[model samples]
Every structure is written in C-alpha cells, then in structure tokens.
Target: MGTCKCHLKLRKPEDAAAACSKVLELDGENMEALKNRAEAHILAERFEQAKQDAHKAHEKDQNDRSVMEMLQRIDRLIKMASRKDYYKVLGVDKLTATARDIKKAYKKLAVQWHPDKNQDNLEEADKMFKEIAEAHDVLGDEEKRGKYDRGEDLNEQPQGHPDPHTMFFQNGGFPGGGGQRFFFRQG
Candidate 1:
C-alpha cells in the first residue's frame, strides 16, 4: 500500500497500478488495494478498468464515499467518451457555427434527448442529454469556443497537472503485449 501510494504521489500511475495489482494478488478482497488500483486506472485514463475496480470496492463497502465518488467520475468519463464529438452531438458545423446557431441546435437536441421525455429509453436519453449539455457548455462560452476552434483542449488541465494518459502511452503501458490496439479509443 505504501509503495502504491508513493508511485501515485510521484504521478507514476502505471507503477501504482502494478503495486496495487500485486496487493490484490495476495488478497483479492482487499478494499484498499481495489480503491488504490481504481484511482490509478482513472489517472491512467483507463475508465473501464477503474469502473470495474470501483464496482468491486463499492460491493465490498457500499458506504465508502471514495469508492462511490470514483464510480461517479468513471461513469462521467465513460459518458463523455461515448459522445466525444461535441459538434456532432449538437448537430452543428464546427467551422460555420455562430453562438446563436449553436444555441438553437443545443436547445433542439436537448428537448428531444431529455430523459424525462424518453421514458422507454431513459438511460440512453440521459446519456445523450449529458453529452448535449457538455457540448453546449463548451460552445456557448466565448473563450472556450475560441480555444476549441484553435484546436486546444477546452478542458485543458490546470497548471502543474500531469496527463496520465500521455505518460502511460509514452512509457508503453498498454495492458497487452502488442500495444497495437488501445483499450480505450477517445472519440
């Protein structure tokens, strides 16, 4: 656990994951190990793996706040990835869209995809609503829209924030040997 924490503190999520995995091998039901590994996977942008670990940890302790928070975060990331093309979600042309145009598109889609209006497919509609809202949130704001137009990540990390996905890929940390296929394809 200490080794895992050290690796995480150093922003070496792959190492933390490995250390946590070792602990899990010794005790599959170790809540601490599961929680640590879930966080490590999340830092690595391995949302599915994180979700799995979080689910296990939640099962072990339903009252665990950290576990529940990790699950929620993983779910949000998964939803975001499922509908990554913000322009597509809003049904707007990125190059030609004005703020007004984007707003109109968002409103149209929001009403159609709103979960309350889609009782039979509440889950799907909820996901779509979240995606539409996320798209609009970015495109509606002038500064964020400008950043997006410039090919910058509108959700750019704050200063000194490390991107674990880049680090994981750069260090050849893909789960399987070949590394030919990514576990999670963003967008």
Candidate 2:
C-alpha cells in the first residue's frame, strides 16, 4: 500500500495500479487496495476497469466513503464518454441542421461558454467552449462531419492536435453537457 501510494503520488499511475494488483492478489478483500487501484485506473484513463474495482470495493463495504466517491466519479466518467453527441453539444439537430444552422449554433454556444465571459466558472466554461469548438471544427468540415454522423470516434487525436476529451476525462469527467443518457450495469 505504501508503494502504491508513492507511485500514485509520483503520477506513475501504471506502476501504482500494478502494485495494487499485487496487494489484491494477496488480499482480495482489502478495501484500501481496491480503492487505490481504482484511483490508479482512473488516472490511467481506464474508467471501466476502475468502475469494476470500485464496484467490488463497494460490495465489500458500501459504507466506505472513499469507495462510494470513487464509484460516483467512475459512473460520471462512463456516462460522459458514452454520451458523445457533438450535434447535441452544439444544440443542432443532427438530421436537419444545415451548415449555416450548425455554424450559428456553434457560435452561440462558444460565446455563452467562453472562459472570458464566465470567470466564476472558468474551468467549466473553458471545457464547454472547447467542446463547442471541436464540434464546430468537425461539423463545419463536410468530410469530418460525415464521418462523425456515421458514428466514428471523433475523440481520436489528430496528428498535432492534443485530445481535450482525454484531458477532460483525466481531470474529472465532463463538467456539464447535455446529451443522451447512458446506463452502465455491473455484471
């Protein structure tokens, strides 16, 4: 557990996850190991895996605050990832949005969520602003929009463009975005 905590503190989540795995092998019911591994997995961007470990921890001890918090965070991240509807982000109807309408919608959202305009919630606003920009960048381009419409992974990083979605998930999941609801069940 000390090694796991040290690795995690050093931001070496992969190493932390391995250390936690070793602990789990020795003591499967160790809530601390389960929680630590879940945190490590979250840092590693393995939300589904984290959720599994968190569920196990919860089953072992539902009263554990840390375990419950981890479960909630994992649930939120899974929900956010599964609800990647760019059209919904831009407030455009996927089926009927014209290029002009898409552009208009994007502009509106961009202004509304601009960090400069929402200083009190700068981080949240900035995230929303980026999402709007990404949506616009894809929807404004005919080819990219076509691919996105067909359910391709628009979250994939471009050659030189950093992936905001990855950063977003790493930090704490999507702050606030309206889209289709997704449910994940523990099996």
Candidate 3:
C-alpha cells in the first residue's frame, strides 16, 4: 500500500497500478488499493479499468470522497466516449487533418446534407446538417479543438460561443437568409 502511494506520488501510475495489484492479490477487499488502482488507471487512460476499480471502491466505502470523485470522473470519461465524434462527423482523418482539410470536409458534408438539397428526406438531412455544423464549429476552432482533444466536457456552450445552427445560416447556407423557418420541420 505504501509502495503504491509512493509510486503514485512520483507520477508513475503504471507502477502504482502494479503495486496496487500486488496488494489486491493479498487483500482483494482493500479499499485503498482499489481507489489507488482506479486513479492510476484513469491517468493511464484506461477508463474501463478505472470504472471497475472505482465501482469496487464505492461499494466498499460509499462515503469516501475520493471514491465518489473517481466514479464521477469515470462517468465523465464514459459520456465523452459515447458522444458524437467530431472528426467522424466531418469526415476528416484525425491523424493527418489540417484546418483546410476540416473546412473542406465540412463544406462537402454540409452541402450534401443540406435540407434544401434533400427535400425527399428533409428530416434526416436537417439532422445531418446540424451534426455537420456542430462538427465544424468545434473542429474549426483551435481552443475548442484542444479542449475536445483533452476529453473535457463540452456540453454547455460557453458565453459568446457561436451557435452551430446560426453559424450555418451566417455562412450563406441559405440564400437571402431564408429556410430556417420553412425548410426544417420542427418536431
């Protein structure tokens, strides 16, 4: 246990996990070992393993603040993973994408999915358009892209951040600022 703590304090999470694993082998119900292992997994970007250790720690000590925090972090990681991937939505390859690549992909997808162009499948097109717009809005901005890359929560729009829908209109997605009220069927 002390060895685990020492490794964690030295910022060696893999070593800490190994130490915690050793302790768990001797005492499987050790709360400290579970909590430490969970945190180490989190730092290692193994969210699934972190989730398991966090749940086990929570089960052993429901009132532990560290355990609760681990659970919360695990939840955030899970939610972030499940959210729409902006790169996939924009059709840009994340590994070799430049800003120009992102913009070109967004333009192509937006035109392809525009509601006016897909009148036969208006609802689906509108949904696709919105997704494309949001993907562009995030991936286009460096600050937002950095945060997104770090896997931070971006559910709330910060003050002054442009709305993806309005941004599409401002970029002349619709001729003469027309289509928002008529083209998309509000459900």
Show where candidate 3 strays beyond 4 Å. 1-26, 29-49, 55-73, 155-187
TM per model? 0.48, 0.47, 0.54
> lDDT value for candidate 2?
0.85
Model 2 lDDT per residue over 45-140, tens place = 899899899999999987888888778778767765676688888888989999999999988888899999999999999999999998899999
Kindly give the stretch of ten consecutive residues in candidate 2 with the minimal lDDT sum. Answer: 171-180
Compose the digit string of candidate 1's lDDT tens values, residues 1-187: 8999899889899999999999999999999999989889988989999999999999999999988888877887776566467888788898899999999999999999999999999999999999999999988999987766545556677567558776667667754334575577788
User: What is the alpha-carbon RMSD of candidate 1 to the true structure?
Assistant: 20.9
In Å, residue 175's CA in model 1 sits off its true spot by 58
* Number of the top lDDT candidate: 3
Once fitted onto the true fold, the runs of candidate 1 whose alpha carbons sit more than 4 angstroms away are 85-137, 140-187
On TM-score, the stronger of 1 and 2 is: 1
Error of 3 at 14 (Å): 15
